[model samples]
Target: MAEQMSRGSQEPIRNRFPTLFEVLSRKTVAPLDLYSFYIYMRDQQRAVDYLDFYLDVSQHLILCRAYVRRLHRSVFEDTPEIEKNSKRSSYILHDAGEGPSGEKGSIADQRLSAFLRSDHGSRAQSPQNSHGSGRSSPAGRERPPRPSFMTLDSPGDSSSPGHASSSENVPRREDLRGSAEKILYTYLLPGSEREIIIPQSILHDVQEAIEGPDQRSDPELFDSAKDYVFQAMERDAFPGFLQSKGLGNLVPQSMMFRLIIGLISVFGAVWASFILILRDKPRTTRCWLILPYTVGIYFIFTHQYMLDPILALLGYSEYTLFDFNRMREPFVIKTLRMRSMSMLLFFLLVTVATCCIFIFVPGKDL
Candidate 1:
């Protein structure tokens, strides 16, 4: 029974992210395997950097499943139905009648009616229109008199610029509440039963693994970074936030790693250049020349896609890097496959160049 339950749980994970499952199944895979899993999640041979968009959708679905499970457990827990339905006196649903006693046609109601009739009669008795003093009001030209203490403007009225501007700036409580509801439904509530069966931990593990050892060691670091990102995004646009963070010395972990790699590569390139200039042999010189260019190209081409793993480290949603809607287009998938292939090729070239520069080139010079 335990084995069956484990298999049942694993099945949903396999179906949702087969690449990630396969990568996890491998014992010797690198941390980048997680990033690759997300990239190739939809494709066998290609993974665009933008494929990270599915990560967000997957997270949303996972959150939705959890919400469903929590709601189910909360609803079906041991509790009396009558007690659940009971309300405080303040929360009681009152009748729409005039008062608590259900009384109507009272003196107050009569007085209110009389006041409305008198006000209507006063409005209807206006003689001079707005044009001039002697100009008698035309039929239906009698305008409603403005109240002394207050004014009410129709929502659709365009005549009052100030009123329209002020109303536009006033946030609608219904809109704000409705937006909150829509976000909850879209990201944290399952529309169907299938989503509720899938586990979130597996996906989170994959994302964490790809992020790096730093993030995996301390998940709270990523949480803090995510909170910072969310706050920055709320205050301004994503691009602007990125710029501000950059100017403020808040460098991304991926960029830091890349910078470290770049500095090392620059040293290697300089060493190789010197070796090439001093070396007399043609074959040895060629090997030394290729090293710097290969390393530089590898870093340049892979930097964008590399940001995914970095963001994963920062606890940012993959949707920040890519959109799920693009996942459906065949052209986009093909382009991503091509890019992935190019990056792989560049990586292979860099590896070969490094090996040659260190091993073969030294041997030839000796």
Candidate 2:
């Protein structure tokens, strides 16, 4: 549905962007897919390479979602009135598809003027945002299409020369990118999508996040997008699967490393107890002798004081409630530094156990 984005240019978006992908069902376009693309772009922070090429080639386009997926690249890349380094501003999306309804150029000028005045500080505005939810646009206005497999269905899928094939299982990157473009063009570009006006400071933080220390880190590309976009990502946290498939696989003998350590301690106590028994000493003291070691090992495994460091080493993101600006906070830094010691300790413990076995066991040679 279309209505006035401003005075006079109430034309439908399809006429302007004129891309068919704009009308596709949304199911084919997953939020995570879009988030990934956002992650890639936002990481660039300021570099949109080949700007004019995209702008010109995509002139007949609406703002596609973040990714480059399908055949439609039609969107009017109208020069935004936002100037360089406008610290405070909000993005206003206008349906370039809709021809100017008001006095020619007035609507675009109005949108630009608002962005310029705000210095990019205010909320990004879109026509959709102004329209209440579930409300239809006035007659003859264009609305975003729901994306679907049927739309992307190629000639191979349908035996129709102009259509898509039916047998493709997974979509390619181009497909994803095209779909993303359409989403952006229709839903996000103009005053259609929710205007997420992030503070410049926050944007800087996001840039810093992806661009690591020494300024080499990949930027957090997803920061500027819908919050729920990545809810489906199963981040590869530990590479534990690799370990489990190989050296890290925990059989019964090594199931819980803690349990293994306890078993070793118990064996030590049992051996010591046997020695006492052979010398005609009481057997009851054996369990008592082993109790401390069992308790100690149990606590160590449960608390994982050592493992935290290791996990951090394996690239865990860190956050803390404590403010450090006022105090030295050396302890906090120190603790963070030592987060990876668990992996080291596991090896060290193994070494210590080996030494003990060689020293204490009868007829054992190391």
- Taken over the whole model, the C-alpha lDDT of each candidate is 0.34, 0.30
* Alpha carbon deviation, residue 11, candidate 2 (Å): 48
TM-score of each: 0.25, 0.22
lDDT, candidate 1, 183-288, per-residue tens: 2222223452112112355434433432333212111212322333334333433233222221111123444565567667867776766565456456644565
In Å, residue 130's CA in model 1 sits off its true spot by 57
Error of 2 at 213 (Å): 45
Each model's Cα RMSD: 23.8, 21.0
lDDT of 2 at 254: 26
